[model samples]
Target: MVEHQDVSAPARLRVGIDVGGTFTDAVAIDAATLQLVGQAKTPTSHDHPDGVAHGIVTALHQLLDQVGRSARDVVFLAHGTTQATNALLEGDVAPVGLIGIGTGASAVFTKRLAGLRTIEIAPGKHLPVEYAHLRDPHDAAAIGGVLDRFDAAGIRSVVVSEPFSVDVAEGEDLVADAARSRGFLVTAGHEISSLYGLSKRTRTAVLNAVILPRMFATADLVADSIARAGITAPLMVMRCDGGVMSLDEMRRRPLLTVLSGPAAGVAGALMQEKVTDGVFLETGGTSTDISVIRNGRVAVQYTEFGGSSTFLSALDVRAVGVGGGSMVRADLGARSVVGVGPRSAHIAGLPYACFASADDLTGARLSTVAPVPGDPSDYLVLDGPGGRFALTLTCAANALGLVGEQDYARADQEVAALALTPVAEALGLSVRDAAQRVLATGTEPVLDVVRALIKDYRLPEDQVVLVGGGGGAAAVTPFAGHVGELEWRIADHAEVISPIGVALALIREQVERVIPGATDEQILGVRREAEQAVIAQGADPHEVSVDVTVDPQSHTVRAVASGATELRTQDRSSRLSDDDLHRLAARSLRVPPEEAQVLASTAAHRVYGARRRRPWWRLGGGPEHPVRVLDLDGVVRFASPDARVEQGTVGDGTAMLPRAVADLTSYGDGGSRAPALRLLVGPRISDLSGVLDESSLIALARSELEGRDRREDLVAVLERRA
Candidate 1:
């Protein structure tokens, strides 16, 4: 069972941990106060299966110790790791068996997926499979024969895909059932996506299957470490789309977390810096990731995995090979010096000049040499005590005084200047001039990517600002100033912003389907489905809000839902009086006081007098009774007609409420009686169940009001009973 923290309490601590290529960072925050309590960093371990887990545990313990807190004090824990991304990028994926269930085009589709074996069964678009095709004696034998072949080939995971599976998934389901019965890990295309792109959807399912084993192993180690530490807080993993999902959800769809680390940094910039519209630059030791935020939203697009498009939604980010640790080289052949990196000092197993000691720097050479294999750029090399090390852009920045002691990993300005002297001589320039040129060359690619993103997205130039984050943020700030006339700001705790972002991210789920000419009711259904999906993934149901978008021309509908995880506490002392309940029912039913009736009342929910009834013919319509209900405090809520709320009418307070609340009451009701009222206020639904008297109920409501606008926020619910 998932443990829920008491949100009604003053505050609960949340810890965010992010595992990067070079370092693992942790941050602890007081969610109620939105204040940073503590943070820690540890070197990332990559050689062992438990490497990431070790880093996470170390960082988390350090953070807790700094804050003078215990593991038990934590109410929420989230993690963002590059493990999945690294596995995919390094070609460390498991082999998969593709079970194609379509006809004419199935073979061609299967052939397009490299490194996967394919088998085709029945085919056709939306064709109903005969009962004999699934369970008949010969059909079962044929399916078993395919499984046998896959087993012989050592295929452990299978992807079941068919044409039009998004609309009708019976065929895919049949194949999945057969595969699973044979003890194979099965991925169904319909389960992976409801979108109409057959090829992309199939590729997505395959990708999910390929990455499942590695992700499961990593998740197990991390979760076990957290559990052994006696922390009961639910664990969430960051998603590439800049939100979070439960560990179980990530295990089922690990592909969605491919670029989660970069996404988390972008989310951090948005939340920590409070930038509504800006270009986010997350400069890590190895690479710089650039993403644009427009109209207060992170740009998301379908992700391409391993050179193939997948149905996963990810932050639209472009990574450049420029960072603090990029190697500086003199590209004499190109008539200009250049800095190229996606490789850093960490990958090269070399310490920056500023971090190296005199002994380590002994035998350093000023001769022009190509340090990188097969590269034509002549670089300055140092025969260190441990090994030969190349001078990098970080050393140049340190020499130029762009990175101060507080921000620079190593604060040896003298050593940086000494290291650059050799490069200056080789390049025939002054030391300071050489450093400046190196910085400029390293930043050019990053600048181009940022400018292109802004132009492509048509971001508002006047409002746009550049927000820098991550350990290499100092390397990005100079470029931010040089990029056009946009204002620039580096977020507080920029070095660990990704973890902070992971810590504060909300549970999110999105559902997209090709439902052409979808009615409002259909769109709403999709929205409800999305809300339910997120809630199931450990989000609080009452805190979930869904946004639905319908493109009639393309017949595509997308629904996104997000919710907070704070647990509400019930105020057992205050319960509704009989008269108060009657009044609430009357108001909710929109009837006169005398005409209103309370059919039943309970601590969980209440049932009001039936408003409308259907004939016996429509009575057994599925499992739902054909009757209308009223919002009698804890009772059934009447479904309000769907309508879009215009922006700015409710003020910014609504935006600050974690998520938007669905208004069951009309605007004329003074913006009260939201179903999520108790959730937003951190009170239990049963808190209003046992009030002794009308005056007492009024006093109870007033007493529960704690923050600014609390009274105004709950005035309508209180007024109905009063």
Candidate 2:
């Protein structure tokens, strides 16, 4: 419960709800401080006639009551759900009608689109889609026949796909209009992706189309409930790419919400911890989701659906089946621990042995049995005086003293050690050794994923950190980090991280176009489109920042815009002094205050540089000067191993762009390429790393400063490339 000093006035709050498979969690936070004020949990009402929406409302009401607040005080509202993902996993999706257009080679391409007809969503079940090919999509007569066939097949959602539609979408647009006119929810391939792959684009649209009806109904129900609860803010939904999109945007691109469950937890870690370059591990009762944030941005890539590739971009999260409630799998006959689980005590309706009193375990006998049918019968459970208690990974961590009292998963260490005595006797070892063996076995898989992510992303071993969140973080992440020899910390309010993430997430939208050799005007056009897209979704226009990327090899011009609908930075508490900013940066750098110096300054940011300490045993080149960019709000907005920061006005920065790029560009066998560049113009950290060509980079740099005053402060940050 939130203990407010005064509840007379309406407290400004942001409410977030995350609908998980087993529970729906809601949290309310001080929108300005970003502090957790209240939270509530309710069982996921899957069996209810109203479905998960009922659970959301129930949790929201509970949270409001707990905080002594009302829904009318909520300045922002957002939610993250697993409904779309579960639908695909369970084959509970609406049937879709696919209309393929074009002739000759494109006609053959249309036949390939029919492959979705047998898309197996599960072991024995497949997505139900009916495909129709039309040589001329604009032929109103032909479109009517397709609709009739679709209606006969009981399909209301339609997808229009034509070859090279990314280049020319007029035909696909016309067909989509015709379908919508007939009361069908329609999706066009080109709208989902700007890439030229016909098959991938159409497949992505089909994936989005399959879940349209269910998601629409659920979104509408939740929206109406929120409105009735007195929340006037535009409702947002968490996306799979670690951002929030308005409910309206989700209606158009519901596929983006498929795997957002893990993204929500990572987003919480990112915002709350001010994580720059690190991997976030969110450990749940049954599994852990691990993802990366490089250069202050979450790593994202095209995700696969039902074992097929799609153009949907999502956070690259990897899951490991080792968590707090994971049942221990042992080889009792061999007197050795084998592995941890994908099955958990929670699923088996058993309580953790550590949570029980020590007296309850008197004369307890260890028995190994499969928690679920067909699972290996090596899972250890203790039959005690209280009841049957599962010796889980959480028990192991507590027994080994790896879980502290301050941890969310904390339990009585002595009691945990006593509960594991049965296992110790079986192995002829001390209880701590048995527990150590179990934790090591459980964290092995998680360590593998961490190592693989580090290698794949080329993260600097010295700088990479591991931050953990979720209810079971203490059970897995700390020991995994110890084994992997990485720095780690648990997030505050880890159990409710998902809801906090939803509350703090910014409104985001991305737009892309395939234009061979896109000019300056074309690049800006895409940038403005992204900016407008988020504004349309209720992001404040003045607070919006669009980062544009013009890729020459792919000829893809991409823009990502992010903004806050209601500026949460309120009161005089947000801004800090220059000395405070430097102190914050030093703590973030893990260096002494004296060693951290202000390298440069802009209106809203201070660039602090510190000398990298090298190992005394090994001789190397001169010490590196790494830099961290700290905003007045005391958030580390960016960090790099080494960077060149030069502060000047917009005109000065524009004039110095070429020289800076030339000075920092690296030369190697691969050829010369400019260093990663970012300009701090006011509060916006304009990322120019995506512009590959030198001239184009300059043009983009100038474009970022286009509307700004020539004398406005600008800080150019060029990350030195070796």
Task: Name the TM-score of candidate 1.
Answer: 0.71
Choose the strongest candidate by lDDT: 2
**Runs in model 2 with CA error above 4 Å?**
1-9, 570-595, 610-624, 632-635, 665-672, 709-712, 720-722
Q: Compared with the true structure, what per-residue lDDT tens digits does model 1 show for residues 1-722?
A: 95444555535688999998878889998876556778888898787568788888888888888877788889999999898877766666776777666445555654454333232111211111111122222266777877887788877787877778788887788778888888887888899999887778877787788777778778889899999987899999999988999999887888888889889998887656656568999887778889987644588998775456778889999988777777766665443575556567766666777667666666577544544487554654666564677677778777877775567443577778877776777678899988888888788788788789889998756556788787788776654556456778777888888999998888889898887656545665676688789888888766565545555456777777777787433333444566776676665455577865444332333444523343456432332211112222333232111111111211333332223232332244433332212211322221232222233223323333323343232211211111
**Count: clashes, candidate 2:** 0
Best by TM-score: 2
Which residue runs does candidate 1 get wrong by more than 4 Å? 1-11, 43-51, 103-138, 331-343, 347-349, 355-365, 382-389, 409-432, 567-722
The stretch of ten residues in a row with the least summed lDDT in candidate 2 is 613-622
